[model samples]
Target: MKKHMKLFSFLLALTVTASSAGCSLSGKKNSSTSSSVLSEDDEGNEGSADGAKADEKKTDGDIRPQDDFYGYVNYATLKDAEIPYGQYGTSVFMDESDESPSEKIVKEIGKSDKKYAPGTNEQLIHDIYAQAISYKDDGTAEKEIMANCDRILNAGNISELMSVYGDLTLNYGSPSIFQFEVMHDYKDSSRYAMYLYPMQSFLGTSLESIHDEISKCEAPNNIARDMFRIQGDDYDTADEKGRQMVYIGMDIANNTDFEGANDMGHLLALEKTSFEEFDSIFSNLDVSLIDVFCADAKSRADGLYVIDRGQCEKINELFTDENLDKWKAYIYSTYISSMGYFIPDSSEILSDYFPKSKEAEDDQAASVVLNYLSKQVSEIYTERYYTPELDKGIHDMFDEIIGSYRELIANADWLSADTRKALRKKLDGIKLITAPEPHKVNAKDAKLVGSSLYESDKALTRKVMDDKLELLSSPMDRMKAMMLSTDVNAQYLPCNTINVTVAIMQPPMFDPKGDHAANLGGLGTVMGHEIGHAFDSNCINFSPEGKYDPSWLGEEDKKILDERADVLTDYYSKYTIMEVFHVDGKLTNGENYADLSGVECVTNILDDKEELKKLFESYAKTWCSLSVDSSGIERLKTDEHSPEKIRVNAVLASNKKFNEVYDIKEGDGMYVAPEERVSRW
Candidate 1:
């Protein structure tokens, strides 16, 4: 899976016009165009139910455009549109497009009553969906939910609590104290390695944010208390218990040495330690947490773990017997929260505690069904939409984009010979996976079999965990694509690989018959954006061979890149969203830098005046979106990428080519002076 952060722009990360302020999932608008803008009526505009009202849109000459390009192009278009797919952007539309295979499969599954045989992939998919939507007749779902709740309450010690939490994560995909996954060895990106990450409660939010009112804490502690109270506790007791849970969370944040946890630091500062050393350094969490939670990890020939020593040390502080009450309270709260998924009656409580969009609320059952069956659904989608020609087209476009990057790097004046060589080596080594490979559910050890929805879900979870555990001792297969081909997204994995799924390669994003301008604007730009990640600030820690190495860039070259990035930071920091929410320039610099590089790469490949103009228009169109909603406000704080409107406007503002093509003069909405424009490519 792509990391929680550091995603490429497009699909979810990219923008484009919608029917209203929020993004639309389906469209019925016809393609409309102007010399300066591509209207929603253009090709691929089929069923989008988002974007500004056609009557409300001011012609380019009707009004005085602000120097704020994003405001001029995107802000006035706001009309509080509905987010049908629950998310507000191109990603939603891409996933729900008429051509979307997953959507088709979901609809197909929803209309079917065909019984799948046990031990088959279809059966697993059916069971996951049936259980998710509460359509299963058996009482296993209720039992499953209660059983986990019982486990939490039954934990008599901190060690036992840790074990139960791990079980919850391993079997039910619930939140836990720590998270683990099979990832490319940072030291050797070509191979798989197990990575243990501190839970989001520790890393997702800042310390100050964590200390805010219960309303501000991760999910409402008050709700957790309410759930506990409902279980049997009196009001006061439940409230105190909830407070204890909140306090433990706060303490974790307060004691955490959060000085360096940024993208670059995530790669550079963490030290690798053996399991024995891990046991000593964070003894409270070692064998109890790792062994019981992930037995395969303990038995592996390679027992190495990478950790931020400072963070782990603080975690140790919370592990004493003296803090057992707090630990137990937190455990009980999370266990109840986890049960919310299996218990349909708990939806009301879960809704109030956890943030969710209206679409998510209304379509909860359907979304859950599709999500749990993602692998199988993706397979169905791939079978319907994927083709060799489509794959080849995207692959060819990616290669060309790489070639463009090579030319840009070759011409870069600031990079020294050695630094450029290292960069080229990394670029050359990038493994591109453009298609989804074959996937089959292994039902070899599905013990939770029967007519029980809960048992079926438990079995599915166990199977997933088993596969993950197996990866701990297995060799990484370089040829295997990590992401599903049917996924409507693209990514640049830090493993020196770029994955552009076939789903995203469809119309609107990558038109097969479209002119160079449209193709380059959409798909071409995406290719460049992903390639930029290879050399971005966060990814720069790795050498060309994908080994973790900070020496890739010489000191002088690093200074130059840093200075250039500072200019970008300054430029983006000036843009404020939702009035009070300011963009986190440093946090978003990597993606912003990639946006600039992507534009440069695309522009470098085009020479014809008409083609350049279309490319510019297409690029702008790619990021055109309606007004942003409040839900996006939180994203502004933590998301690595800036808003879609900002991505398009900011990147264009920094490009001389864009200025020339659009005829943007000084003081124009889209203009940025040559001296102020920032670019690292």
Candidate 2:
């Protein structure tokens, strides 16, 4: 199996528009462009539901534009839109135009007879496409993965067990028993440090959930049974193996340290120390599968960091001959999952294990090539579909928004001088990078061979790991990308960078020919939201250059900031989804505040009445969705984002420009009275 990276993005890591916003899925909208700005009520009844419904709208929908902005603009599109087969929800992010360069590139490369020099990107692109078509799922990849599993089971002693785990890490580019990586030091961005991460859980991540889910073990058991059954084991034997792995997973989960090892809260919870401290902390624990600590491999450099002593303690307790078979079964379980879920469709080779919808069936081949060499594919996409005008226009708008933030901070009477300085520093340091920078990867640079897709993927993993490890000795390259240069996503990485990729820079989210109001409302708001992460409740602890520094703000200033943030938490908590679940204010504090601040930032740039209408509509339209109501209910309960309706209504309601432009009065559903408003920056 190819190695998977553990990502770390701060509170507003995944932008709501840049993504499907984690199940707040979207659908296509064909809204009428006619004017729908709110007209004054004729009758004396204000704030009445009847009055709201009577408001004029450009398109037909039951919602009043002022009351439910998201619904008014997107209701028709979402109501009529059908969720495609096998998709849990619908999203605008999923709407790829027919002319998208990714699929075109795949077909073009696959059909090309032109050859390039060895180790060239052109060669890799051509080879990757060929391999995607040549892939054989005939259990070969599974057996290859299982060989590592067998090594774990056959180990006679701790040394041999440790040896296999090391080979898995450094040689085959697989997840190690003790995962470690050399990356930039968060406290000081100039140098890199080796970080020893915590044990990953199989099912549940919470300690209490471990006792609940693992105790039942139904999910993991089914996974094991289904995998075994697909691999030709009898149902009875498969069922037994399933139960055994669950029991093993149960033991592993019990030992997992799950207090604060997540993307949302790592900076506040994780500790850093010297290499000697790391060694001393674990010396008595009897187990430390240190990074690249395989028996025969040599580990260079001395900088090392550990999450805490608890990690080594857990590993020591778990590594024993008595638990060897349990370890093998647990590891083998991952192979079953990979082979079953991601196995290639085969007319003769790898069996297509499950049935898929026609939509997915059509995307299978191109999807394979896209997933196989995503970064390179991103390069191809930019080369074929690069729009310089839109790119420059968006960047110019981003700069204006950053200036607005600066002006807002400088004028904030409540903020102290030190807070203002730190914020301004962060604004200055925020760098924008176009992912898979157009033509940066020369056609003759990166290389891959004419092997199976499985092997080619493994080789690609090694290339990524090679670059990651090389960074330990190299200077911090702020321009180097940390997140996937995905086709339709934007991310705020801890490296103090806002990465905007290829496809997302195009239609729906942005347009070169579109008016400034619409473009700013759509993509500018998204960019501001990412910048807002730098000063949110959680991320404000980090320094200007993205280094963690909780003490940067004065005690008095922090207290005032907390009070301001409290208003958002309380405000959003009152909102409900599916008419049953209430949004968790504290859980969504960072994101809600980001939404409010993001809109405020973008709204600061333009003042025309007509422009404001277009801006607000574009903002609402960007999040238009037809998600399964059940999914929205769950996301409202657990997701950091407010549901789509609340995301539009609540966010716009707080904006002074929105209220002024829409003529939202005291009793209007979209009006938040002056005293009750929350302005968090």
Candidate 3:
């Protein structure tokens, strides 16, 4: 799967009314406690003093309320309630005594003949299960495994593969496809087995090399040091480093300049020139010294590795003029809709004047919009929950989770001693990139000079790419240029130098006062989800030293994980939006895994008795919202993440900790069978 799979959304909750008479005791309140022993009457009957039921009445089994104020509930409160009860609430729509909102939606969708109509929900659900089962049983599994291996094996060339033979041996062969083996063991153990690999091995160099270079240089005290060199600073001071950093930052900013204003005299002349002319200029340049320095810098970053000229050329080859335009459209749309970065939609102009032979402009437009929306949601979350102080808290939570795995490793009855030792080493080598690295573009110092929007954008893109290329050449160091800017809205780049740029920090995604549930539901989930990617199925195959190693878990444990994932795929497949829902369970499985796991991880931390319940309530409030539009609904079909409603339902369903809080019972509609639940840490 692409690194794009790392981004996603989160949960839902119920409204809190002041009236005691109208409120359903079985709703939000029941899930808030650890005790699950409650009767149907106990479930309902909680209204505020105002006499209005806190739990709004359901119609056609849809728990969503008619009133806009009661439309969507909070995630934190829902989690608080569910964490103790193990269900949404005693009276959730998914309960056996009640039909789920989705089931009702399925019934409604069934009435429509349009492929994308609302009635196809049930079929969509059924199809996802069928597909998942097929993926597991058909030759698809082998094909997928092989394809991934090929991607890695062919990343650079045969020489690179030979250098990482031990790593390749574990994952490359038809018979010894190591990822499958790990999955097999997880299936048997009901526990996750991850194989950690180093990013350097695949990229053909080590991040350590890059890190050493950065260490030799001083750190910058402010953004200026990164932009230009200054005197009187320590060798390791930020000011000295700032000069190189500024150059890279300016390069990216300039490339992004869509307007023509930033174009230099020479660049203008080259713009109208042929590709051959451009190539000539590039070839004549003495970039070797810069490349060497960049390579050194990348080594210092710890997790990043250089993508050699050969690989860069290959990636470049993948970009045709048409594809480049599509990519630009996607980026622009993502900025506008998701990141809330205000950019004019020139689709009208493109559609009217740009030749249709250019590409599928409509598809590009939609994708761009979707990316923007996703990013917008992410920013909302970052603004609400991300802070320097909270960083340590989050890290500590991760440590505790890791500690649990340690205990599990020690006591596992099935694993052989050899496997255990290997697992321990993998655990020890887990590489974590918290927050952005300190060595990215210094936006403050970078000036855009393009005269036209298009020119500026192109210039900025090229500049950014060059800066990144420079970093890739250097050793690994965490770059926070992206994170420090409140304007950045998304993240990408899979190597050791994790890049979180400023483009990801924008609105709809990051409103300080936006409802907590929605903010976290958007960006918080995304951030945590991305962090989870560091240890996702694909990343887990490598070792911390950037080498490929197949020593994470034993065979038995891998099986358990597959079966568990199967359950998730099966369950999500059952969800339908209009009758024509397209839940691509196989394609989305990795994201689903991350979403589920992130919720579990975050919930474990938030559920502590010592934590204030109100904070949980605030978190729950984030997921609350009004209904979406037809276009928004249509987009859900192709989306990798589950719809908001299901995101809450599926996660809470499998959370045993939630069951304890909600008093959810076996055979309840929202209940997940114990044997069917998937747990990966």
Candidate 4:
């Protein structure tokens, strides 16, 4: 799957808009007009001037004077306009005010008395519960719910369950596992039917089965299960508990086939035990010493043991003498104090795993040690350096684009005075946040010890769980913090806040010095697209305060909006992917609205400046880069946004300016009959 596909249609609250102070770039004395702008000396041969004139005749009667320049473009270029050539510069930095049309719409919606349907996921749960409740027999609902829960809980053997849970806990941690429970009020008729709850609640009921499975499994580091057993056994030595723990860790580390001494080496050093060791072990049939050594070592210290060769090879691959020396000093200062999770604390044992060289306490040796330590520390560290720069650039770009929109708003002749006033009100409520909040996850804040991998793992897990619980309990606050974090890709809150941080402000989206058209087509379109989301059917009912109300428009107005949306849906449905038809009209309605409206808004903004319109079209060409991926083709079937070709073609078709600039004829692919064209603000 494409990494960014998930983000393709999603709304991000992270967008920053232009200032509300009525800022105008056009008012700047330094800004130049198209007539004075420089131009390339490329030939401009009109192939079918007669055909264009004939086509123009058809729409002449219906064309309003104001609409004549709706998509006009001035091909002139300017010498000092900061136009980029070839691949533009990588980093762009700017500071600007935040103003946006989407924010205004959201704010106006907030004041309205529109009702909101539950989120899709929430609605699914509600529907399931309602179905369960509809049965006349009270036991029927309860029984069905229990049956489904039991099936999920008991689908595999106890050992399999343990393995699955252990893997899940290790990788995703408990919060993700919490997604498997069933909760029901049984009292509230509205919501008492069937709802999913956290999975932790079921662990208690199946603890015995789980333990039995763990006992049967030969692998090591069923980490949580092992810890649970040790705790339950009261740290008993009589049962050889320490040995069992060591065996578990070894089993986990050595399961794969790779060149390492044992499992410990495999897990920590990313190596596997040599085939010779396996052969020798099978022939000797004496594994007691290995088991005892592992167990006793684990009791006092947490050591990630692997064949020395594995660690040696990895060290060679990653470090050089100079780099190693710096790392050694850093590691001793940072991680040497905390070694309980992985290696035994006894000096003799510690020296066996990590020996201190007395010779010069030399930088070379220190470097080696430091290199190893850095690798260990990096596992938990999370910091992105480029986020701030990207955040600043995106915000500046958004501000400029939104400022252009204000001009369009001022010039819109189709909207009624009352509607325009409401539109302005909506624009006023848009909120912008630049970077991710400081409170977001950071490795520096997490206290991790390299000596004991187990201890470090447990500590990290606990920290993450605590964090998740906090987020779940106070979702709004979490959302706020996320918006502030510069590392977050993008976010859009039901609230009017549009947040665009540094994480997603890079690459194909927004390049600081790329062709003006490409940059705008990428991030600029994305910004406008998200803002348009605020006016989707579901969002339209909500007021700026994030409350569901329907006060913004009357029933007749809503019907008109719905009709317009239907037209969009029907039009997009004609597009095909992988031989499958377009997305369900209702399912994709929101994204469709955003696409259409976003294009209209951005295009209108560009129309205010003929030269800018040309620049914008040039930028849009980049978005048309095609891919051969079948899945991408298949996406057209269920994706709300049309293919790039269709998006550009359809939007441009309705653009009178585009027609004039391109000299489109009556039968052109992008031609839209005047009466058939639809317009909505």
Each model's C-alpha lDDT?
0.62, 0.62, 0.35, 0.37
lDDT of 2 at 396: 84
Query: Candidate 1, which segments miss by more than 4 Å at Cα?
Result: 1-100, 110-120, 130-151, 172-174, 202-208, 214-219, 257-262, 281-287, 304-311, 340-366, 413-422, 440-449, 552-559, 574-584, 626-636
| Model 2, position 543: C-alpha lDDT score | 74
Assess candidate 3 and give its lDDT: 0.35
lDDT of 3 by residue, 1-681 (tens): 001211212222222211112222223234223322111222232211223244433222223221111222332223333321332222121223333222233233333344432212233322222222222113333343334434432434332322233232222221110111111111111121212111221111122323324332222223233211112335456343443432322222222222221212212122122223323333422232122222232232222111122322332342343233222222222122211111112223223322332244333332322221222223323444456545554345345545544554556555567656665565554434434322322333223323322222334334433454454334333232233222233332233223333223233443444544444434454454554554455444444443334355555655655566676676566544332343545545666776676555555544543232222223333343222234324334445555544455555556666555544444233445576555554
| Top-scoring candidate (TM-score) | 2
Which candidate, 3 or 4, would have the higher lDDT against the true structure?
4
TM-score of each: 0.79, 0.81, 0.41, 0.46
The better-scoring model by TM-score among 2 and 4 is: 2
Q: In each prediction, how many residue pairs overlap at the backbone (N, C-alpha, C within less than 3 A)?
A: 20, 3, 191, 77
What is the C-alpha lDDT profile of model 4 across 1-681, one tens digit per residue?
011111232210010111112110011111332111111111232222233344233221221111222111111111122312331111112101221222222223323354433322122222222222221222432243233323324433323333333333433232221231111111211111112121211112222222335543322223223332322433333124333333322332233232222121132232223333422332322232222211222232222223333322332232233333222222211122123113322334334435544452332222322222222211111123234556567767777656655555556655556655555555556666654333333334324332233333445454444444333233243134233222324544456556665434556566676655556655676677676666676566655555445567566666766788887666555433322334444556676666666666656545444554544454343332222234344444344455443454445555565566655544333445666554545
- What is the model-wide C-alpha lDDT for candidate 2? 0.62
Tens digits of per-residue lDDT, candidate 2, 1-681, equal 011111111111001221111112112223322111112222443443444334345455444555556666765565455555654455544443443456667678766899866655567777776665555567776677656656765777655666665666565555444556776676665567667766665533333355556555776676666656655778888778777766655665666655444445653455666555664554433444554453311254564556545656665666676766555555555544444433545211224444445465335656766666666666656666566776687678778988999988888878888778877888889988775544444544444453467676667666666665666767777786654444455666565777776556666677878788898888888888888887888878777667777787788998988898887888877665543467788888988888888899989888898898889889987776555445555465457777666777778877888888876775555666777767865
lDDT of 1 at 321: 72
The runs of at least 3 residues in candidate 4 whose Cα sits more than 4 Å from the true structure, single-residue gaps closed, are 1-393, 404-419, 440-446, 450-455, 478-491, 511-518, 577-580, 583-585, 607-630, 633-638
TM-score between model 1 and native: 0.79
